[model samples]
Target: MQSHNQARANAARRRQAETGESYAAALAAIRQDRLNEADHATEAGNPPVDRGPDYFHDKPVPEVLTELVRYHSHRIAKHLYFAMDEGRWRSDFAEWQAMTLYKLTDAAAHLNLLIGTITAYLRDEGVGRYFLRRYLQVNQDHQVEAYLTPRVEEHLAGLTGQPAPEHSIIWHSVGSDIASQSGWNHPEQHEALEAALHALYGNYPDDDEAFNHLPPALRERVLALIPLMKDQEHSGAAD
Candidate 1:
């Protein structure tokens, strides 16, 4: 994995130099920093950055749901970048673009799961219908909403028994919007962003395949750690 990441980073740098694009160069730098961090942590006998609390903990459901959204949102953003890069390089534009869309759909499905879980938790907490209705309102103007698959929207509408709010942040789309914008705009910046994503995540199975393959126990553990990891990343950035 490390070698693969390094090779991708090198390629990104070369691309950036050839095209005067900054995206790949920026990504290579970030990847190097992360690799260094990982090495230092391993040497110090510290747990990996992503290692976190077990899934079946007694934490508040809202908290757990929040973390799940954060974690998957990060993953989805990485995949989105990769898909974008694939679109840039591959001759089969339609196929690559469809793959990208599939990744986005997978992201939406994961978020829908988090929303369902949160709703159930709110009900248990005795949040009244009025409050719940207000809670579900789409209050934000987020670009991430553009990526939400129609199927996921339909599924959420079925669950709510009303049309899903056309503009809600239910999936924590705010975080996704930020992730998606990290290396946007200039060509170099975009390529660098793509390089960083490829280095970090490589290619993973599509969302449905990955979700279906997970054992229940492992899945829960992953759910528990997702938010915790996000918190750690934020804290690290702050520091």
Candidate 2:
């Protein structure tokens, strides 16, 4: 029989293949699911523990949520850049451009909704808006590189033939980072965000930005094989 660790590693690899998540992210999800299951089993015999909306483990709620707001805001900044870059990529690749923008907008909408709710709950719109608007203000100032150096670094690494690093290396999008923190303090909102994400991208809304930023010719060749990849994913699911 396979050892438990081997089973978990295999499960994570399958998840990474199907969801296009980095290996660390897929592993994190697997571990988190196990934890959630264990917690649920434990709670089944006990009374539910309820807390106030503003409760963040006794930390200043607004302060912590504001940081969550920053995380989403940063991701939204990257989406905006990618949306424009798609158009700038080449005037002739209209299908690719349209697909990118369509997916990106769906991605942005999720993040925007998260920002709006976080601000409303904090009862101070300025708390979120100030940080969000600064990202937008990159147009008037020379803040693009300073604001998005991490994203640029991914593309740079890809150009040099490096594989995508583990999630710890790019902590910006860790589970407790931008992607899963969508209203996590609120149980209902957390479930809703999870559903919306699966619906929007058929997985996570994030693209492998580094892979997408590869030279157009090479990227196109890979994209053209996507249907075959989909078949592989389905077969893995069956197993």
Candidate of highest TM-score: 1
What would the C-alpha RMSD of candidate 2 be, to one decimal place?
Answer: 18.9
Clashes (candidate 2):
0
Candidate 2 per-residue lDDT over residues 1-239, each given as its tens digit: 56445566789889999999898788779878988986676666553243222223235434445445554555565576567777667466867668677859866664645544443333332333333344345343333223333443332233223454454254223323333444322434433343333333332223333234335754554555555556888999999
Instruction: Quote each prediction's TM-score.
Output: 0.31, 0.26
After superposition, the stretches of candidate 1 with alpha carbons farther than 4 Å from their true spots are 1-63, 138-239
lDDT of each: 0.49, 0.49
Off by over 4 Å in 2: 1-61, 123-239
